[model samples]
Target: MTSAISVDDVHFAYDDEPVLRGVSLSVEQGAFLGVLGPNGSGKTTLVRIMLGLERPDAGRVELFGQPAETFTDGTRLGYVSQHSTDADATMPVTVREVVTMGRYAHAGIDRLNDADHAAVDDALERVDITDIAGRRLSTLSGGQRQRAYIARALASEADLLALDEPTVGIDADSLARFYDLLGELNDEGITIVLVEHDIGVVTEHASTIACLDGELYAHCETSAFLESDALERAFSSVRVANAHRPVGGD
Candidate 1:
């Protein structure tokens, strides 16, 4: 099968400090590839290279069969950043208007055609946010706002979705719900690259795990990675002796 993303001998540096050292990875289509690392571990840099936002000093980055930036004209690339906050909800923007902006990346300066309109509607529906399509974006709850962003990503009509720390501050319910969407999207053959700090939770949901600590330690099946000690070393911080669970458990 054709790979969704390929990073061959990729190395980058921010000033004199080296971030990535000869990083090479290939994410298969329909595969959910997770990138786990600590702060300043080149996780964000690597993604930036993939998105054509930053240039790598050496090696090549490819999407599909061609260079990442040259993959296609105006294809969708969903990105949900880590620092997103719901505190800005009262900005006086409607959900439809916000989601519609996702199409701007693909639409020409002239006007949106029929297909673009259809894509916008389908994207909102894909995330099951059609009911609130007409509602104000600032009025939605935290979970709903996050889902709205997910819809925004979908509106990109992207063949590939790359997210950075998507579940950082979300509640347990919202986290679970968002994860369900990731699984559903992956099931539909949408390629996903999840750059996350916590691997314990997402490993079970991903098809492959790329354990990164400055370099790729292992890229293998989730079951194998979890069963071994590598996972612990890669994701040591996420483990809590007593996790905060909901009261009166089922």
Candidate 2:
């Protein structure tokens, strides 16, 4: 079977500053991959390159066997961005309406047909937010809104889902539920890629883990990652720095 995502010797830089260097990894179909790193580690930049939002300076990216640049199957990949939290809360759109927008990629000139409406309903049901489908986005709690966003991505019937910093600002209970939902989606054969900060939680949940710190630190199964020297090196630097801090100094 073809890999869901493939990045070969990828390199990226911002002006004179390099972010990613010789990074290469592949995610298989139905795999749940968790990408972990500190801030400014190029995690976001790597994501943009995968989604074709930004061009890589070197190497190549392929999505489902097609080059990222030439791939035009918009409906095949679903994306839930970190900025969803900041969506204009005052905008008076219902949950169902927001989810329905996922179908816009395939809607063409005609408005939502029966299939589109059915898809919206199905997505809402899958996310267990059918009861609140009519609620305004701003009226829902944090978890509910996050579910609605995931439902919107599902409305596209995408096989690959990518979420960036999805659990930021969410309560523990909500974050647990959100992760459960992701597991369910992955169980049903949707490949998942999550960029996250919580190392323990991500390592516990993800089938595979990829570590980055302006470079590829490690990419391995969760079990192997625990014993890998790469992980030690990655966090050892942080530990050494923290140890040197003066007790009363900033």
Candidate 3:
């Protein structure tokens, strides 16, 4: 019933080049909203503006009814960015340590309290990474490492989880398992916003879809979107084949 994220007529640009033009969307609470777009379609830029990491040239963004620029409570919003091999390659921290870092927003300058420890433990278990909680982050496989990252976000007990291209470079088996985990989390009532390029996969999992190609082509229920011409407008070539295919089918 409540909106987790609301973007109203947003317009953004990089220098002289326009990126997003008149984009508007509203993601309801507990909704798994998938963002699909081609390269340079401003999907990531729109997410950044929603997270307050970047400002839009025009229009306003709200998170949980509060202005994105003014909302300072980050503990309630969790984010997992695109694969960053550089940042993870040289890290020396353990999985538990990484997950514990999420509590920093709440704990501030203090040490981890009892509640923080409980949260971290629960998160690790939720992601099925508790067995490797003490393992070095750099030593784990790609799938395990990604689970650790998700655990870190979960430790914050965030109500909204946003991921940008989360399944990139992972094996098919791992990707399937990861999507299953996301479904479990969503079942627990966490609002999910996923930025993905794969139309079939996003359609299968997300309840709502937003197609962006510098402009908002469509933002509606996944079923409605699949039945409309919006996908053809935004992604004419590759998506044309999958546009009519029922979601979750080959």
Number of the predicted model whose TM-score against the real structure is largest: 3
In candidate 1, how many Å is residue 193 off?
Answer: 1.0
Each model's TM-score? Answer: 0.82, 0.88, 0.89
lDDT-best of 1 and 3 = 3
The superposed Cα distance between candidate 2 and the true structure at residue 201, in angstroms, equals: 1.7
Q: Give the Cα error of residue 61 in candidate 2, in Å.
A: 0.7
- Scored against the true structure, residue 210 in model 3 reaches a CA lDDT of 94
Better of 1 and 2 by lDDT: 2
| Prediction RMSDs, each to the true structure | 6.8, 2.9, 6.1
lDDT of model number 1? 0.77
Question: Candidate 2 residues 20-128, lDDT tens each?
Answer: 8899999999999999877677888998898778888999999999999899988888988776645648888999999998999878678889999999999998878
lDDT of 3 by residue, 7-50 (tens): 99999999978888999999988999999987778889999898
What stretches of model 2 exceed 4 Å from their correct place?
85-87, 236-250
- Residue 109 alpha-carbon offset, candidate 1, angstroms: 2.6
Q: What do the candidate models score in CA lDDT, each in turn?
A: 0.77, 0.86, 0.87
lDDT of 1 by residue, 94-183 (tens): 677777877888876868788878988997887778999888877777666767777788888787898888776567866776788888
| Each candidate structure's count of clashing pairs | 2, 0, 0
On lDDT, the leading prediction is 3
